[model samples]
Target: MQYSQLGRTGATVSRLVLGTMNFGPHTAEDDAFAIMDRALEQGVTFFDTANVYGGKEHRGWTEEIVGRWLARSGRREEIVLATKVFGEMGPGRNDRGLSALNIRRAVDASLRRLQTDHIDLYQMHHVDRSAPWDEIWQAMEVLVAQGKISYVGSSNFAGWHIAQASEAARARHGLGLVSEQSLYNLLSRHVELEVLPAAEHYGLGVIPWSPLAGGKLGGRSEKGVRRQNANTRFDSEGLNDQLGKWEEFCSERDLTPGQAALAWLLHRPGVLGPIIGPRTMEQLDSAIDAVDISLSDEDLAALDEIFPGPGGPAPEAYAW
Candidate 1:
């Protein structure tokens, strides 16, 4: 793939981030390794994981599998690795959150599981409403100074939360957040209302997760094979009609619905790329196809009519 700097940072990353949340949970270790090998071979050098992946029973299993892959593949330096914090990792009261102690402890644990000394990008999984942004930044600053993390990022944060964090970092003369991860897709454009604007203002790249709307845009569910994640969104009224129109439009353009959805995000102003969490190698191969899809202006308009966004941004989207 295509390459872009991670937001305004000097560092560069692939447009498609390989998400390993399914490793050891939905995918066998061998399959996970093979997918990773394929991902690297195909130029997908960014890998995203989390400390609390692999469900409650096996919280760090995904990281462990990735660690094994890194050790065996010896390709850690080739990847721009990202992982998250702020999820409950154990029963202890201090096991989670963005508190200084937890941030310190969490990064160490993640590094060990990932088999890497420094994380390319370390992100807070969610905004901790109770934690002071200064306290959080102070912890992140320590990591940066120690060379444990290259950049800081946020996930599932609103516009105001990003502003608050950025201002806090500014006061401390820190680099602040370099990226924002949100649940953005052709079908879900909530971030366009504010998150996208905020990230753009703060020079943060926006990475869209669930870019296929939980596989609703993957087309397999439309072919009589119902995927588990594709059914909920289809039960609603007019969705089938919309999806039918979508599939027809993609067919006319010789593109898969999945490719169309990803292409839509790729065209978005603030989006760097969409996260592709593939459980199988076939899925991995299919996702990479979106990178080459050249969506015309007419194609975007067609997609907009089928899956509308939250208008433009903020008051213009709501008022005048």
Candidate 2:
């Protein structure tokens, strides 16, 4: 697998991060273990999970599954495990958010559920506007000092949120956020407007979730169409047109749609890796093979023509 620095940090991580959102929910424990085994065999060491995953009935079920896998496989030392906070873990008012009290309780709960002593990367799942940066940074400081988490990160944050958080951490002489996970794909490139630029500016690695646009680019057009419910992006006619062109382009190059889509993300600037969440072993194998598929300048140009991004970041993309 290809490797990249985790933002400006000295740590090197696999270019493909295995995400466990489906664990204990769509995928049974046996299937989840098999997928993770295959991923590790293929040299994927980064694993991403969230405290809020594993369906509504079982809030931290995914982490529990992962913890079991880690204990059984004894692969904890080999993996750079990541999990997120700021999601409701209980019905209590303080069950969510980045408040100092919640963070303190949440981290301990996550650690217990994960069955690990420390989390490699602890990410804020979303921006908590009500929580001041100073409070957030102070809470993070406690985690860092206690060796509960190695690095901090953000997800689904606005560009200004990154800047503000980074500045706050710097003021406290902290490491700040080393990475930003955002929803970025060939079909969904809104992050190009500001988030990507902000991450680049702050020297934060960009780990893109939904890199395939929710399986639309996963090489199964019929399946994608069938799964297009009200909340899915595949319901739009314009997206269908783009998908047609995308499929045609991939077919011409003798590549699977998923492979081409992942290749495009692997080449994007400021991207450390794309988080691939597979529900089955076959899907995980297919995603791992994408690391070998490289896109040339002409191929990239063709992809741009099919699914154009924000024309190239911020004011230049609109005004100047």
In model 1, how large is the Cα lDDT of residue 60?
A: 92
What's the residue-level lDDT of 66 in candidate 1? 92
Worst 10-residue lDDT window, candidate 1: 226-235
Specify the poorest-scoring 10-residue window by lDDT in model 2. Answer: 221-230
Runs in model 2 deviating more than 4 A are 221-230
Q: Rate the local accuracy (lDDT) of all candidates.
A: 0.91, 0.91
Q: lDDT score, residue 208, model 1?
A: 95
In the range 1-320, model 2's lDDT, one tens digit per residue, is 99998999998899999999999989999999999999998999999999999888999999999999998999899989999999999999999999999999999999999999999999999999999999999999999999999999999999999999999999999899999999999888999999999999999999999988777786654545523433476456787677778888999999988888888999999999999999888889889999999899999999889887789989899987
TM-score of each: 0.97, 0.97
Angstrom error of the Cα, residue 229, model 2: value is: 4.8
Q: For residues 1-320, what per-residue lDDT tens digits would candidate 1 score against the true structure?
A: 89999999999899999999889879999999999999999999999999999988999999999999999998889999999999999999999999999999999999999888999999999999888998999999999999999999999999999999999999998899999999998777888989999999999999999988888777765468734563374357777678888889989988888878888888999899999999999889999988998988988887888888878999899898
All models, RMSD in angstroms: 1.4, 1.4
